[model samples]
Target: MTVRPILETHSPSSDPSWWGAILLGAVFILAGLIVLGDVVAATVISAFIIGIVLLVAGASEVFQSFSAPHWRGFLLRLLVGLLYAVCGLMLVSNPAAASVALTLVFALALIASGVVRIVQAVEYWQWFGWLLLVSGIVGIAAGLVILSKWPVSGLWVLGLVVGIDLLLHGFWWITLGAGLRRDNRAITA
Candidate 1:
């Protein structure tokens, strides 16, 4: 039996266009940081912003659902939109409560995302099951930690975490944006 080498093809050496993506990522990281800072400075302000965002998003969803061609899907979306609106209203009505609510929401989302990722990994790459499982476990652990520190933790830790995340995201975006710009130039060239 002869061992065969895996042959790979490479494009001619040219400037890689990944710079734009990097720059974009950096910008996002920076934006995340800014948002995190805002959250830290005033949780109320952050809550207000979140409320406004939710309101806008919910309204958009409702409008889209109404305009959708599929009535059944539209109805479902409308229900979701209503829920979003209610949550947004609650946040606005009592910004102080937003911290706890946000924490719970974040934890739930993390766990849900982790589960989805794990499932996808299991289906697509059995060999990667461990990776996905670990990710899911981490997400669940994080959620549990957040839940344990709710209220008081929601007030201080949440803001700090959000700020750090924002900072990281902004940096990521900036890097991605720059990379994209570079790639666009290279493509044009």
Candidate 2:
């Protein structure tokens, strides 16, 4: 008896469907276009849309939290949700200020995430921990650079960030779809 890996070894017959690849590619192209369009839009408008989304999400969370059976947890969640809702509403009230606020929030979040990642990397060096550390450093550096640029960076950063996100997501989707198609074919064969 021999032990085997969970993933099957690749073979020449294990080819992804052409149709699936084309479909995935089309979706990726669409996503890229949407992100590009969003980037071209004014930051204030983006901020306003974000504010509205936040407001809706917070309100829904608050309602769900309060409706829960556990009073203590409900109270805690409700309070947090209320705070978020209020902040979101404030942002929507003044889109200009909201954009600045969102930028600062993003900077802080990036810094915090970087610090957490660095700590985790120090604790666990295996399984892409080093990659996490490098990413954290890059994130912190980027946040600092954005902070230094202030309002100017805020105006242009949203589009660039969205573009990068869409690109990464599209790539991931294409890869996953291809892999799935390949696996499906392999199973059939």
Candidate 3:
């Protein structure tokens, strides 16, 4: 087949569904905002899911350790497995409490990691030093915000963050879809 024939066959004008992408993006933005509006519940659900995942991972680890007793790290694996299982069980038993505790840990880790980032940025001064510094500052601010609210903030932090991410992604998708549609129009023109 000639190149012209192939081009015509695969042309975007042959498919007029580009508008659907914009609609999908709008829906995503709406969903993200809705989640942000009810972040507490979302956070709780997220924690619950994590707890369940931890439980399964822990159980699997324990089972695998026993199944492969000949392995050199069998004892270590067993210990880790027991630890995971215990933590998972605890989280599963009280998801609300788990949420608060997990959030607290996350906040503390963020603070520590932010400090590390700041140090790295100062010392390394790579091409992305500014980006690192800005990210570090934001991380610290976010960590402090979470710490200030503590248990209360824990209930909604994860969900709020996720909602924001989704909202941002939704905007990107919409922009991308619009760009694609514009390109299609130009091609047809």
Candidate 4:
């Protein structure tokens, strides 16, 4: 049996992209730290940003609806666009409320996903089922914790999650950069 590299043809030699990854990792880590420092503010800001994005997406969809060839499709797209726009306006108008609502939705999603994963884990128990089980348990625990705190949790959970995500993402990028650098060295030598 033989194992093949996924990108056998691509060489890491002479590529300076690793440095960029490292730089990005550092920035992400810094941003994570900053967000963690003021989670409430971070949550509000994130909600506002999401609202703006939704608004833009809604506008784009509405514009595209005009190009739809059929009346049914046009009506569907227009309706979706209007929904998005309305939701975006609501979010923008009250980011704190939006954060609370979104947090509740997130908690529910986590619990539902955890339950689904647990069921799937039973089926896959013979092969890496333990990992899935652990993940599912963690998800359930996290959701429970968030729900226990409810509205209070909403203010900080999103920001804390974002910060943690950024930190992990930074670490991943840094590790990737280091690996690339090492591979480059090996290839050059």
* Number of the predicted model whose TM-score against the real structure is largest: 4
Better of 2 and 3 by TM-score: 3
On the 0 to 100 scale, the lDDT of residue 36 in model 4 is 95
lDDT of 2 at 137: 76
Q: Per-residue lDDT tens digits of candidate 4, residues 69-173?
A: 466778889988988988898889999989998888877877787788688768756434554566567667777888889988988897886676567556656
Q: What is the full ranking by lDDT, best candidate first?
A: 4, 3, 2, 1
Per-residue lDDT tens digits for candidate 3, residues 48-103, read 78788888898999999999999899989998988888898887788777888988
Ranking by TM-score: 4, 3, 2, 1
Scored against the true structure, residue 147 in model 1 reaches a CA lDDT of 77
Tens digits of per-residue lDDT for model 1, 77-172: 998898888888888888777867777777677667667756754663433345445555666666667777776666655565555444543453
Clashes of 2: 0
Tell me the whole-model lDDT of each prediction, alpha carbons only. 0.62, 0.65, 0.72, 0.76
lDDT of model 2, residue 174: 55
Q: After superposition, how far is residue 98 of candidate 1 from its true place, in Å?
A: 2.1
* TM-score, every prediction: 0.53, 0.54, 0.61, 0.67
Model 4 TM-score on a 0 to 1 scale: 0.67
User: lDDT by residue for model 2 over 88-173, one digit each (tens)?
Assistant: 89878987766766777777777787788688756645333465476567667767776787777776665555454445445544
